[model samples]
Target: MTGTDTDAAALFASARERLVDAPRERLGDLQEGRRFLGIPRAARIVPRGTAWHLGVLLLTDDAVLATGDIVRSRAEVRRGFAAESQRRRAELAAAAARGGVPEGATVHLGWHPIDLSALDAASRPLALREGDALVRWSAAGGWMPLARYLDERVELLRHPPERA
Candidate 1:
């Protein structure tokens, strides 16, 4: 195989080894609720603000694929009949029924592929850019290589810092 092909295969293998699966109950919720083309090769659920963001990675035969950010807001009661709030409530209910989400959390599953052009102004700074590699673990932490990002993220999820 060519050098590039070999490198890609190595990267894919590394990612596969480092990847951690999301909670089993949430897999179907993520697939059907988020409308993913198929089950992600690997996924990680990390807390973001009062929400949880599911970071997904899919290593396909031809390319390394990822979703933009699958966010689910923390559960809370809304007093108004605002359309958005109503929609969120319904989404939360569906996700809860499927055991994909915790109580009261609202799911926002958009089909956005992670790419340079696809990133908006707000998301650009957070994404790491190395030639063709661009990825983000959270809203903070600036930019970093994909492999480093995965390693650090996996470690963080496994051993979160104790809150002061």
Candidate 2:
């Protein structure tokens, strides 16, 4: 890899390594726009027409850097990821049954809505430096497996939907 690539990878790894099981905040306990440092507790993949998106990818960067819904540690990150994934899986299925994920859209890591229908205009997707983009994310690394992270999360803004 190029020096820059190597450096970036190292930087990403260091950030991920720093994450450990620590105290975190729950989603409902969070404010609308308040900023705090925390981990990604769970993620909801809301499907628009052409892409899948996370209503919010709870973060775990640090209480000092940012905040929202918090996941305690790296383990919680994994657990939340899996749990959210399962939850969204069912949600997507139902949505598909009702309408369908656009003609070419596909769901990777998906989850059910933390709430079936609710829109708090004050609620903005949290942005944290992960992988190459600062988007609402819920993973240990900047980049994650398939639909878990990567371009999918970064491009979430491009998609639109009611809720996960």
Best by lDDT: 1
lDDT agreement with native, every candidate: 0.42, 0.31
Model 2 reaches what TM-score against the true structure?
0.21
TM-score of each: 0.42, 0.21
lDDT, model 2, position 147: 29
lDDT (10s digit) by residue, model 2, range 88-120: 444443333233233333433222222102212
Off by over 4 Å in 2: 22-90, 93-164
Q: Taking the tens digit of each residue's C-alpha lDDT, what string does model 1 give over 30-91? A: 43334358754322233222212224543322334443434454433445666886765555
What is the TM-score (0 to 1) of candidate 1? Answer: 0.42
